[model samples]
Target: MKAVVYEGPNVLTYKDVADVSPKANEVKLKVRACGICGSDVHGYLGITGRRIPPVIMGHEFSGEIVELGEGVNNLKPGDRVAAYPLDFCGSCEMCAKGDVHLCLNKRAFGVLDVDGAFAEYICVPAKVCFKLKDSVSYKVGSIMEPLAVSYRAVSHAGNLTGKNVLVVGTGTIGLLALSCVKAQNPRRIFVSDLSDSRLEIAKKMGADTVINPSKENSLDVIMDNTNNKGVDAVIEAVGVSATVKQSIDSLAFGGTAVWIGISDKHIDLEMQKIVTRELNVKGTFLYGFEEFRTVVEMLNEGKLNIDPILSKEITLEELPETMAQMAAGAGDIIKVTVVNND
Candidate 1:
């Protein structure tokens, strides 16, 4: 099997590697499409210590099952599927309570040491595979992971009906979260980003207003647009001190703010503002198993529009260089997905 292996920091090589087979209760999949995430870029640059050398780094993916290990009966060969990517111990207390993402023993693909779907073929637990409809393209199926992340963030925001909402970033997750908020029929949706191109895309994806924080103060713009009352809810998709502060400051009294970005490990918070305003602050990581399944259904049922989400499609051989370009600051690229033509 040929894979783009991460040999070291800022280095990836396309070479032949040993083939992988399905373990018991697992399924071997011929990967069709895999989306490059921001985390992968960070790992490539050696900024994040998660992606160590010699590991394949791709998690958002969809494929066709080529072989099933023993004890697997719910699916068969040739079935198209998208995976949850988080291999969790199903008998844990967190798993029993439907919080698989919080499972005590969990290994997320493409993070830390677990090898992901950046190769021709990979194997995953049969339980994490979700069958995809014929109508859903492999490209769309590949993005279910991030979509699930956005969906979970929106779910944390509670109800958005007729309420003014603000999304503090126009990145892929922010845009997807804006779309999820739109589905609830919010009174208005404001998106903030430094890039005008991403802001334009956000507008088409149902944002009522776009704010370039570099040009104008986002808090002032959000406040002025909402008639000085501030937004009812905010989804902070940029995990930085400034944006996290902006999200907290741009919310109305009793408003909810959900933080999903992991750009920074630690940042100072406005403790007085949150405490005085009685604001609800929640930090969300990855999506639970059910959220991943629901995102697939949302795309399958045509309730979610992911067509505007993907920015580029490349072959597996092109992933390394593409990732390098992305690290060098390609603001126009939102989501780059790798496809297997073979």
Candidate 2:
């Protein structure tokens, strides 16, 4: 088996490695397609401490089951599947409350304490694998993880029917969030980003208005669009102090704001404004099992079109250079998937 092993900062080696086998409760999958997430680029650049070196870093993927473990009966070899990527203890309080993503003992693939799908073959817990419908391609299946993230973020805003919504950042997650928000039939959707290329894609993805903060004021656009009342909901996907502030500043009184991006920078907020406006601020992490399943179903049903969001597909051998480009801020590309052609 060949794997792209992360050696250190900005170093990825494509070399032969030992083939993986399934544990008693696990199943081995032959990799098909795996998408490079923003977190992967950050990890490759040693910016995020979540991904340690010597690990195969990829969690958004789809594969075919080649070997089933001893006790696995629900699925068999030759089944196409996508995995949830998070291994959580079902007995935890969070899990009991259906918040498995926040379980006390949760481990995610391609991140902490687990090897992931940046290889020809990888093994995952059988319980985490979901059978992919024949209609869904491996490339689309691999993107379900990110789609689920966007779904969870929009879900945090409650019902969006006939409400104005603004999405900060037109990155992969932000663009996907825009699509998900559109599905709820919002009155209008606005997307903000620094990249004009991404903003163009956001327009095609159903953003009623797109703003480039580098040139024009995003708050001014939001204000003018809403007649100075601000949007009813804002999705902050950039995970930066400035974007977070903008999200807060662009919300209407009694509106909701969903923060999906992860960042370490400290942000100052106007507590007085929050209290006076009675605004609802929520932080959304990864999706739960239900949201993940819903996204898979949505893909299967063709309710979510991912064609425009998929920017490029490359072979495993090109992973290193691709990661480098992404680390350097590949603004033109939205999503890059590594296809295992071997």
Candidate 3:
């Protein structure tokens, strides 16, 4: 198998590697499409604590079952599938509570203990594999992981219908949040980003207002637009310390700010907001197994159209340079997906 091997910071190579097989309760998948997630960038840049060197680094992917191991009764060869990347202990308190996302001893495929799907094949636990509906494309199936994250974000942010909502940041997840939250018919949707290109993409994706914070003061603009009342809800997709501060600052009194993006910094909260204005702020992780399955069904059912979110698609060989491009920020890109043309 030809896999993308991450050697170190700013280094990756497409090289031949030994093929993988399924475990007793696992299935071997022939990977079709894999989306480059922000975590992958962090790992490639030697920032992600979980990612170790000489690992296959990808988590968001969709593929077909090329082989099946013993005891895998529900799935067989030739089934189209997408899987939850988390390998849980299944006996921990978190797993017992159905909060498997927080499994204390969880192993995230491709980043933690196991090699991931940045290759021609990946083996995943049968229990976590989701059967991709025929109506859904491989591209979207590969994206179920992030959409599941957004689903969790929406769940925490509460209902947006008839409520003013703001999404700070127009990255891929930010845009998806914009699309998913709009389904609730928000009274007005505001999205802010430094990139005018992504802001335009947000507008086309249903954001009612787009603010380029570079030109004008976003806090002033939010105050002016919402009549100094602030928005009813804010989704912070940029997990930076500055964005965290901005999300709090732009929020309305009694408003809820859902932080979805993963960051490297230690964030300090504005404690006054919790007492004086009675605000609600929450942090969400990856969705449960069921939520991952629901995202695939939604895309399969035509409830979500994210074809425009893919900024570029290239063969696996191009991933090395593409990773560098993604690390360089949103220059000529939004989301780059690596595909198996075969």
TM per prediction = 0.93, 0.92, 0.91
Residue by residue across 1-342, what tens digits does model 2's lDDT show?
A: 989999888999999989988999899999999999888988888876888878999999999999988999999999999999888889999999999889899889999547889999999999989889899889889998999989999999999999999999887889889989888889999999888888888888899999998899999998999989999999999888889889888999999999998774577777887899999999988788989999988877777766688899999989998898888878688899999756
State the weakest 10-residue window (summed lDDT) of model 1.
Answer: 300-309
Predictions ranked by lDDT, top down?
1, 2, 3
Would you list the rank order by TM-score, best first? 1, 2, 3
lDDT values of the candidates?
Answer: 0.91, 0.89, 0.86
Clashing pairs in 1: none
Candidate 3 lDDT over 269-307, as tens digits, reads 778876798888898876887788777777777777677
* Model 1: per-residue Cα lDDT over 212-288, one tens digit each: 98899888888888889999999999999999998988999999999998788899997999999999999897787
Worst 10 residues of 2 by lDDT: 261-270
Report per-prediction Cα RMSD to one decimal. 1.9, 2.0, 2.3
Model 1, which residues run further than 4 Å from truth? 217-220, 265-269
Per-residue error (Å), model 2, residue 16: 0.8
**RMSD in angstroms between candidate 1 and the native structure over all alpha carbons:** 1.9
Which residue pairs in model 3 clash with each other?
none
Q: After superposing candidate 2, which stretches have Cα over 4 Å from the reference?
A: none
Error of 1 at 332 (Å): 2.2
Error of 3 at 245 (Å): 3.9
